[model samples]
Target: MAEFNSNCSTTSDQDDSIDIQQLMEDIDFDNVYSMEQEINEYETDQFNIMYNTDDDDDDDDDNGTIEKSVTLKPIEEQIKSEKLNPLSTTIVNTKKPMTLKYIQDEIEKIPDYLMKRNKVFKQLIYETLTTMSISTSTNNMEDLRKIAISIYKIMVIQTYQLLWAAYLKSGMRQLIIPSKTQRAYSTMLPIWPKEIKLLLQADKHVNENETYFNFINAQLHELDDQLKQNQMKLNIKANHFQGYTLSIQNIIETYIEQHLHCLRMEIEHKIELIQYDYHIQILKLEYLRHKPNTFQKQLMKELCHSKYEQETTEQEVNLLKQQITYYTSTNQSFECLPIAHNSLIDSIQNSQIRQQLFLQYKDVAKQSRAKIFALYMKTAKEQRDEYKNKHEINLKKMWDAYNSTSDNDKISSTMLDLMHQRCMKISEYIKCIYKFKSQSFVSNSKS
Candidate 1:
């Protein structure tokens, strides 16, 4: 009975050990399965994040409490499919090498807002290439090295091509045409070369690449030559414009001089007539003082019998009216003569006779003064009219000449506008060239 109890206990212990081993095996299997599922989910998330894609079904699955196991192909197969159908792929498989065209397309795909974001642009390119190298097969270092070299070459070529294309698109060609006739006159000066120099100073990366530096130096020389030619053309055009302006100025000056000369002559003629009239008045007054009676008798005879009798009578009446006006204006007595003329007479009868002779002489003097003044005014008006007519004729001639020159292709407005456009384009082109050159330098340094 004691032997039977001991054997039964050993058998039970053996069964317990077997059951425990089986349980351990089942737990290990479950853990491995759970780990695989987790890995699959992580990979799916990576794909969605890298490719910037989302699936509605995936979102629903993620939200659910239940977990599902997924079977996945090798990383290489997945990358190949992504490369073959890039648009359809939900992940960026960086194992594939990027072509020059691909790089160019990527650059073009960058938004305009991102173009000036130099750090961001460089970071994107760096991350893409680094990811590609990391994702490549470990056993294929040789292939990886080749791919890296190809990427460097692609970067250099793409940068150069982008800059060249920008230059072509710019209107630099308009500034320096091969044909002289087609060459335009630039009114605006370009500061692009100076701006490019400043850009180069700010970014020293391009100077590190010998090939890029050489190419840029050659282009700078070409651009300098083109700018010099444009400046020369502008100078010539400016000179021509100045010549026309000077000619117009000379015409205006000559017109002013002629008008002044006419005015001076008219003034001199009026002065001479006034001087002659004053001398005649002085001589008549002297004759009346020396021989008043004789002078009076002669004056009366001339006034009564001369062919200008009516004119003489009118002159006498005007002189008498002037004497009356002077007496009234000065508040003087009409019975007395003026003080300066009082010495010329002796008695009251003689004074009366002398005053009559003086009044007749004054009438002739007044008439001469009125005639001279009228003649002077008429001459002045004629001179003014002549000046105006001549000035109009000169102005018309100038206008005709200007219009004819402009219309007949002597002055080219289109050339001026084209040159201004070209100057602006050159500035833009310089900026693009500097930008790409700096990018190329950065890419090469990293490689």
Candidate 2:
């Protein structure tokens, strides 16, 4: 049992030792990875500075000369050698004299090749050598060192490839030679390194990109505002057009209504004229049926004659004769004796006798005139009384006739009712026309 326990303890110790060794290997690998990352970062910063310096050199010839003078060939050659043998142990050890500053200067000499492959290469390199540092020994230290150097060389080669790729992408060779704006055009290319140093040194590129984006956004906003304004204008114009159309419609309706009203009034007037003419013709026919005298017929014919008919007929001559007869009859005096006495007195030559005769005649004439006046008044009163009695009787007869519903009376009443209805219809039509006109006026006023 003790032998079994001792064997288990020994196995446990070996396991613990293996675990410790694995832990140490893991630590060393982590350290080496971190160092590689730092070196890559440093190289990146150096390339960025080199790109920025190239840009500055484009602006000023003196700066360009100064940058060229500082360039070291030894470091450039060493970096080139490292690129050629990235995994070779001999190159890394042989190039041990190369410093960080020399490496930075050397980066400027190489053209950018892996311009868009930096991140991809970094990730691939990290993943490819997961267990890079596994053994821990005096002999393994050299191997470890070679591994570290090889990693550094790989980083350097990748950086050089990136620079070369950028240079190819820039199409610098395609630019027009002997052009004053060539330097400015070259600066516009997006082949520069994006490290922090270049970002800080070439702030103008960042500013220009930001400015371009801002300008685009502003233009979009302006276009949107213009669209909104155009829409509002269209709406306003549409409203105006609608209002104009309505006004035109209303005007047309008003004109139509007015024309119709004028036509109606003309038609009504013509109807009234025709009805008057018919009434006159009917009355003339009734008079003729009642056996009117020649004189009465002549008068009515003359009254009813048109202007042309009157000119051709004997109405003017008859009218003149009637006027002459009326004047002759009006001129005759009623007292014959007074006229004779006046003639006799005018014939007397003796003034006193003439005066005595005139006085006696005046007294006699005055007494006779009084008697005639009294007789005339009595006759006039009797005639007036007779006329009043006749009028009353006629009125009573008319009332009885009106009350009685005889065939003739009924016919007359029916005719009268029909005429009344016609008149009422005409009045109602006029009222309707007036109402329509008033309503139209009210609507127009509101509009």
lDDT of 2 by residue, 206-278 (tens): 7643443343344344434544554455445435432224333343234334434433443343233223222
lDDT of 1 at 176: 33
- How far out, in Å, is residue 431 in model 2? 36
Q: What lDDT score goes with residue 224 in model 2? A: 45
lDDT of each: 0.30, 0.31
lDDT of 2: 0.31
Compared with the true structure, the alpha-carbon lDDT of candidate 1 equals 0.30
Q: Tens-digit lDDT track for model 1 on 241-359?
A: 31223333243234334433422332233222222222222222222233324323233222212211122223223332332243234343322422223222323366565565445
Poorly placed runs, candidate 1 (over 4 Å): 1-349, 406-447
TM-score per model over all chains: 0.17, 0.18
